[model samples]
Target: MSKILNEFLSSNLQELKDNGLYNEINVVRGANGPVIDIDGKELINLSSNNYLGLATDETLKQAAKDTIDSHGVGAGAVRTINGTLDVHVELEETLAEFKGTEAAVAFQSGFNCNMAAIQAVMNKEDAILSDELNHASIIDGCRLSRAKIIRVNHSDMDDLRQKAKEATESGQYKKVMYITDGVFSMDGDVAKLPEIVEIAKEFDLITYVDDAHGSGVMGKGAGTVKHFGLEKEVDIQMGTLSKAIGVVGGYIAGTKELADYLKVAARPFLFSTSLTPGDTKAINEAVKMLMASTELHDQLWENGDYLKKGLKSLGFNIGNSETPITPCIIGDEKTTQAFSKRLMEEGVYAKSIVFPTVPRGTGRVRNMPTAAHTKEMLDEALEIYEKVGKELNVIS
Candidate 1:
């Protein structure tokens, strides 16, 4: 490395470590499930995004194995090249059917889905009204679009309406788009889509919903757009197969025209290699399973409610989460990190999320209680949380 690079890294590293902002990522020894082994200790895991527990499901595993035996591993090249396999088409078809869209296009990851979709449609000549608490990927994608970005206060329809009116009336741009997450990942609050749809209609703004966290957690596992029954109104619906679907990849479900445009225009889809045949097959299987039954989704909600009630009863500041994602807010960064550490040591592996991931002085231990978590496991995790909370003086 260059000397200048070395000095820059050393100073930033020291500052983060000194202020308790540095994160130490633990290694999971095996399959990520309700229980995980880290550092030779088994802990009740509350950190994974595998909301439906399909990551280790026998059906999904068998689908992957069967595909690998026949199709081998990789997709050979980019989708724009010769990489479009039959399984790829099938997966996209499944996604569209699941999301109640006319067509869909898949990407390498959830992050790339935002990167690809936003830039493919919007340009610098346009303006974007974005939610203040939107995910980092959506923020970066908006930046990449070169659009004039307006930050709308989190879930404030009034702020969005004013921004939309200003952008559209100013005539400073050709198109004004509104982008938001279907579910705010950090806070677990669902988006106000009905009001958003009405405002978008009034302003003629192109609407985009990044439903990465909402994909399998909302709409009976279809997604947030479906949950609100706005399947025909939202312009673009983006989601991930990685989370509740418990596989790997992202997709944009929309009209046939949008899918066709993205297939030719999106840089990630044109340049990056396609998803593996096995992963595509497995994702298709998972989506089909969800569409067939809501057993897993129901269990996920039941567990979320259980954990939220348990934490709140102990005097922990579990924020106003509307989903299975429960956040135990600890104001100071150092204390939040220590609380998570104590929980891990006590055999519950919930991680601390701090600044740049969340705002300063609002550090939290985010718990994702999946369908895989048994009542027994949740009770044990709650017991551990109570012990750690009192020991740290986080609860009375």
Candidate 2:
């Protein structure tokens, strides 16, 4: 109610509007899948993270319904108190097995998991070498740890080695950790885990990989750490169930000792209520499905290849992507936003990612093709892209 606070907020919001950075959120009127309904328009959804398209799977839905009937809707207390239900423990066990880790712990969301896990392990006395293009969650986690953060150039082994050697040689901290995203969401590029593992060993640095986008996409659906066979090498592996698993939670998979330590020390784990029984059960089923079958994973790759090739054929700049995530590089923020708006208007829904989310001038419209999208649907989407691309003069 303070006039000063109102004025400050208004000024900041106005700045966003003036700069074409203020985004109006669209309401998804139907279920989220490879296609969705936004503002009464049916659009081929290429911006969702449901990589395996398990979010709307009948099996997962049934599992959630059954669990809700049996366990009710919520875990009524914080995990440390009484919220840790059997389903939660089961999911943790399943996740540990899936990730090839000794143990695992779940949190309310991937963002909170990053905040809790990073802060729990790295204190002010510790130093962290972070990848320059790591996720915002990783950046926030590093900040929360209060560590001496040294950002190595993205995917540059030389830079990482130099920083690691310098930090370790200086001996200014109790522990040194290196953190990166296993698969960058924007570019869909896999992290150089082999190089990172070697550096971590040489410097005796703790390794942390946030595989939010890599889970159920890389390593035949296990993750990037598993893709590179670094499960035993990396110290901490974090992932989100909300994306590929079609549920709402996050987890950190690591050694039993590390998981135990997080259970006691991580603020989000200790203070936040545990995931609902329905979510926990659905996630368990989703993990089981991923481990048991590769159908969805294959379909996801097919869709990704189809979409990427189609975009390329239309003369749109699809960046170097090795995973399901595809980016149509637009360079400028305003142009990127305009491009996205035009796509939506043309009945395709892909979001524009700009400054802060990504580096300035590297603005792009990121597309996430899931297993649920049919070939015909992708063809239709590509046609729309061609139409919009020409209209925007992005392509001939």
Candidate 3:
């Protein structure tokens, strides 16, 4: 053991603990459904990103079992060296169709998806204009690319346009790409992609939208780009199979040239083993299900509206969420965490998000109402929220 390493970790961890920022992960005993069992207590789960309740769906479970029985668990080798299976190809094709893209490439995770796609195309000579509030994965990906990064104000079109114009006119880079999240995870606000595309057109810039939270919840399960009918306009559309699709993996949907380029050039694809057969098959089945029906999508929106209305009527500040994600702003970090703790004790399991995940003094308990949540479950959670809110002086 290294003494320096030990001291560094200990000091940082102590700082986190002293600042009310230490995260203690809970153990979910079984499937991550609407109701989850944690340490012998079943709680109405509002923390999961299982937007459409497909994580523990019986059909997806069967699909996974069948694929595992047929193809084993691992991909056996890196994709560049025969790891690519038939199901992987099928998944890529299905994802392309689902995303309305000409071709697609699958990755091990959403984080890697951004890393691979960004670095694969953009390099040290390029400049990336990224949304300030984009996901951590995108931030890390841009860093990995070694590009001249410019941070645009969150959802500010004029800022993006001005910066883009400067970057394009300065003649300092070979390419300029604007990257943003289709729907921000923490705040639940939808990105203004149409304005982004307009800016791209004005400057001939590349466009990338990481629609991790929007895949199954927006555009009738197609995505944000499709919702705006910009399938041909946006250059790259990245999505995850874990969140709403309720499996695990990520993919980039775009033209065949881009897909082919990534297939050969992306480091993760060239160096890392591909997604497992079971996960691939499960993702394929989930995408098919999403394309086949809008039942779950509609139900998800209904639950969101119901929960938002309930929170608002109780005088809680739920932010401007265009999707099903709801955040009850609690302001102070300790109070926000205490509110979440009380909710858990009262049989609800929403998590408190504070800095540096969000801005300081804007701590919140983020609620994610899935399609699997019953009306009774939401009602019960709301009742507990009311009681806790009044007790904590968060509501009158």
Predicted structure with the largest lDDT when compared to the true one: 1
Stronger candidate by lDDT (1 vs 3): 1
Q: State every prediction's TM-score relative to the real structure.
A: 0.99, 0.99, 0.99
What does candidate 1's lDDT look like per residue over 217-308, in tens digits? 89999999999999999999999989999999999999999999999999999999999999999999999999999999999999999999
Worst 10 residues of 1 by lDDT: 180-189
Query: Clashing residue pairs, candidate 2?
Result: none
**Highest TM-score, which number?**
1
Question: Of the candidates numbered 1 and 2, which has the greater TM-score value?
Answer: 1
> Which residue pairs come into collision in candidate 3?
none
Q: Residue 276, candidate 3: how far off, in angstroms?
A: 0.6
Give the C-alpha lDDT of model 3. Answer: 0.94
How many backbone overlaps does candidate 3 show? 0
Q: What lDDT score is found at residue 336 in candidate 3?
A: 91
Better of 2 and 3 by lDDT: 3
Misplaced by over 4 Å in model 1 are: none
Tens-digit lDDT string for candidate 3 (1-396): 799999999999999877777777999999999999999999999999999999988898898899999999999999989899999999999999999999999999999999999999999999999999999999999999999999999999999999999999999999999999999998899999888899899999999999999999999999999999999999999999999999998999999999999999899989998999998999999999998999999999999999999999999999899889999999998899899999999999999999999998999999999999999999999999999999999999
Residue 388's lDDT in candidate 1: 91
